[model samples]
Target: MDNHTTIAAYNLAKSAYANYGVDTDKVLETLDNISISLHCWQADDVGDFETKSSSMGGGIQVTGNYPGKANTIEEMRADLEKVLSLLPGKHKLNLHTIYGEFNGEAVDRDQIEVKHFQGWIDWAKKNNVGIDFNASCFSHPYAEDGFTLSSKNPEIRSFWIEHVKRCREISNEIGKQLGTPCIHNTWIPDGSKDTCVDRLGHRTLLKEALDEIFEVEYDTNYMKDAVESKLFGIGSESMVVGSYDFYLGYAIKNNKLICLDNGHFHPTEQVGDKISSVIQYVDEVLLHMTRGVRWDSDHVVTVNDESLLIAQEVIRSGALDRTHVGLDFFDASINRIGAYVTGCRASRKAFLFALLEPTELIKAHEDKGENFERMFLLEQLKTLPWGAVWDFYCLQQQTALDNEVIALVNDYEQAELLERGEVLV
Candidate 1:
């Protein structure tokens, strides 16, 4: 799409939206301020730079091994740079503790420090992006039993507690240096695969561990903490220690952020519905946007109904400023960079579509009990020319348009990914 054609289409869209009292200009402006955090694990299929022999546990799995997995710190950084270039808005990078630059040394999770991630900090500064940190509690020997913070073994639990404390400290430093508060999220795969009678015991231990880990306070300006819950994973079918109820109560009591992952709930559960409810209690909430095919499959996100509803709810609840949006999925069956671009773009497009909605008009009708009118307007919104506005936003941001993404990704794959020689059959 040329500049002239984009501008003409956007002018039409702007005019059309004005009839419904929605300002296209203001929508675009709001979209510009929204930043999505790109998960670093996508580049390497959750295989970090650590020199350990631990296999992926905790019900976390990555499927399809497309060629060109980043095996080194430099390669991961380069891949992230490429992904940023393809995205439209300024975004942050989310890093797991395992992805730290270990410099060919064996640094256990509990032994990691700020120096190991100084390289990443410098790189983030160079790219003009902020960083979010995660404690890699899974895929370690201590977590093989599907427990970390909630482990019954005192030694194992203490190790994970130490690791999480270090992660928070590192996150604080990263935010202090970059002048953007780093959101450090903690998620563990602690659950029982079969029926268990000791659920309360595990929850008690987990709560104690968290209280101890968070005992040391850091400046909120530099770091904000969030706890993520999972419905059930492969080994955690019977029960999960950090269930949504547990975390919600913990967050509300502690005045901390609660992370609501789209793929972390039952199939019938809608994370969007929980957004408005959760925000009323917590000061802010973190969102991990992903697609789950019948389970927590961690598939790349798409601009589907669920995605749209999540964005719509965020906007409708007037919690846009209080929500921290981030992407979480690992689909190695396709090109890694393509996954990043596709998922990130889909998320942004969902938000863009939500912003383009005539929300005020619809809400006014609902307020007056005009159900038919509200339903009709919402149906009509599905066919609006929001795509034109989206294209113009992409044009303004100087990013690849939807039609051009395939060719761009293919070109990069041929030049970079195929040359890595780590093709998975």
Candidate 2:
């Protein structure tokens, strides 16, 4: 779309929204300020720049072998820069512990330090972006037994606890250097394949391990801690140690941020519904947006009913400041950069859709018991020119609009990704 056509369409959209007392300018400003953290693993299919690549385990797997996976830190950073250029607003990068730079030296998780990630901090500072960190508990020999932070074996449990503690320290340093509170999230893959008889024992061990890990205090201005839970995974289909109830209870009692992964709940359990309820208890929340077809597959996010509801709840509850959005998917079936752009674009669109909603009018009707008017108004809103506003956003941000982004991805693939000399397709 040309600039003139986009401007004309946006003027129409702006007027249409004004009729419903919605301020398009305010919505655009809000969207501009909102930053979603893009996952780094998406570039290399979760394969990090470590000295040795461990086999995927702990119920996490990235299928397909679409080529152009980044083999070095330089390549990964180059790919990420290209992705950022195609995105609308400024966003942060979420890094797994495995992606730390070790200068061709073998550094195990337990011995990792902030020095290993100094390069990343410098890169982020140069790019003017914030950073979020995660403790990689999977794809390790210790985690192959299907337990970490909740292992009955004291040696194994202590190793992971120390690893997590080090990760928090690293996050704190990164945040202090970058002048943003880095969110350090911990997710464990502890569970049983078959029906485990000693569920209580595992939960008790997990609680003890977490208590030890959180004993060290760090400045909240530098970093905030969060715990993530899952209902089940590939190997642990029977029971998961870090169930939703466990994390909810722990987060509430410990005053920690609770991470609600979209794909980590039962099919019937809506994450959006849980948002309002959880915010009432916890101080803040971190959302890992992904799609689950039949189980927790971690597919790329789409602008679907569930995503809309999640965005609506976040906006309606007035918790935008307290909530953090992050992407969590590794689809190697298509262009990796395309997957990143698609998921991030869908997330922003969802937020834009929510922001364009006439929530105040609908709430007024509900308060006055005008159910039919509320329903009609909401239905009418579905026909609004949100696409025009979105295109305007892309135009203002100098990113490709609609299908045009595909051409950018194709151009990058031809010029950069394919030239990396590791094309799988």
Candidate 3:
């Protein structure tokens, strides 16, 4: 749509929302300030630039051989820059420790340092973006036994503990250099595939390792810590060492942020419900937004019911300021850049729908115990002209509209991705 039509539609939307006491201008202003961190793994399908990299193990897997998978540091950065250009609003980049530029050196996980990621820090600075970090404790020979920090073998466990410690240090440096508090999230794939005879023993080991890793506290101005839990993974169907209960207690006791991955829960469980509950105890929470299909499949996010509910809960609970939003999914089967743009755009639309809600008015009805009125207003809201307001926002931000994204992605794929080289199998 052209700017004239978009503005016209937005005017009508603005007038419609005015009757409900919602200011579209204020909503757009607030939406512009919300930054969604884009995961780097999506560009290359989680194939990091490690010299001695091992095959994806410890329950992690990626399934596709699309052409133009970022096989080098330069290619990955270029693809990420393209993704940024197509997205609206300010955003941060989420990086795993394995994505660091090692210059073809044998930099083991335990030996990685800020020097390894200096290139990424410089690139982020030039592009005007902040960075978040993750300590990759999987896809290594040591993690082949389906345990890292919670491993019964002390040698294997210590390696991962040291790796996480270094990652935290690197994250702090990145934040300090960029003038933002980098959130360092730790997620380990420690679990049992079958009935475990020593559940308590593994949990105890994980706790000890975490305690030791976090012994050196960094300034919050430059860094914050979060622990992520998973229900189960490919090799951890029976028992996951870092369950939600374990991380919840650990985060509360240690005054750390708890990561709520929407895909890391039971298929029937709603992560949106847990957000309100977790924030009552912790000062802040990290949200890894992704979709799951019957399991933790890590599908690209769309503006589905679950996504809308999650955004609504964040707005309804008044936790916008206390929550950090980040994307966490990879789909190499399609155009990688298209996947990134689609996921980011869909996520923003969900939040836009939430922000456009007449929340105060609806809550007033509920507060008065007017159940029928509240239900009616909610059902009516489903038909609101929120998409018109969204189109206007996209125009204002100079991004591709919903209708223009596919053609732009196709042009790039033909001119860039297809020319890169042969397809990977």
Per-residue lDDT tens digits of candidate 2, residues 168-199? 99999999999999999999999999999999
Q: Point out the worst 10-residue segment of candidate 3 by lDDT.
A: 57-66
TM-score winner between candidates 1 and 2: 1
What candidate 3 gets wrong by more than 4 Å, as runs, is none
lDDT of each residue in 1-425, candidate 3, tens digit only: 88899999999999999999999999999999888999999999888899985798767777777788888989889999989988889899999998988887998999999999999999999999999999999998999989999998989998999999999999999999999989999999999999999999999999999999999999999999999999999999999999999999999999999999999999999999988899899999999999998988889999999999999999989999998999999888888998999999899999999998999899999999999999999988899899999989989999888888889888888888988886565
- In the range 256-329, model 1's lDDT, one tens digit per residue, is 89999999999889899998899889999999999999999999999998999999999999999999999999
Q: Candidate 1, TM-score vs. the true structure? A: 0.99
lDDT of 3: 0.92
Q: Tell me each candidate's TM-score.
A: 0.99, 0.98, 0.99
Instruction: Give the lDDT of residue 205 in candidate 3.
Output: 95
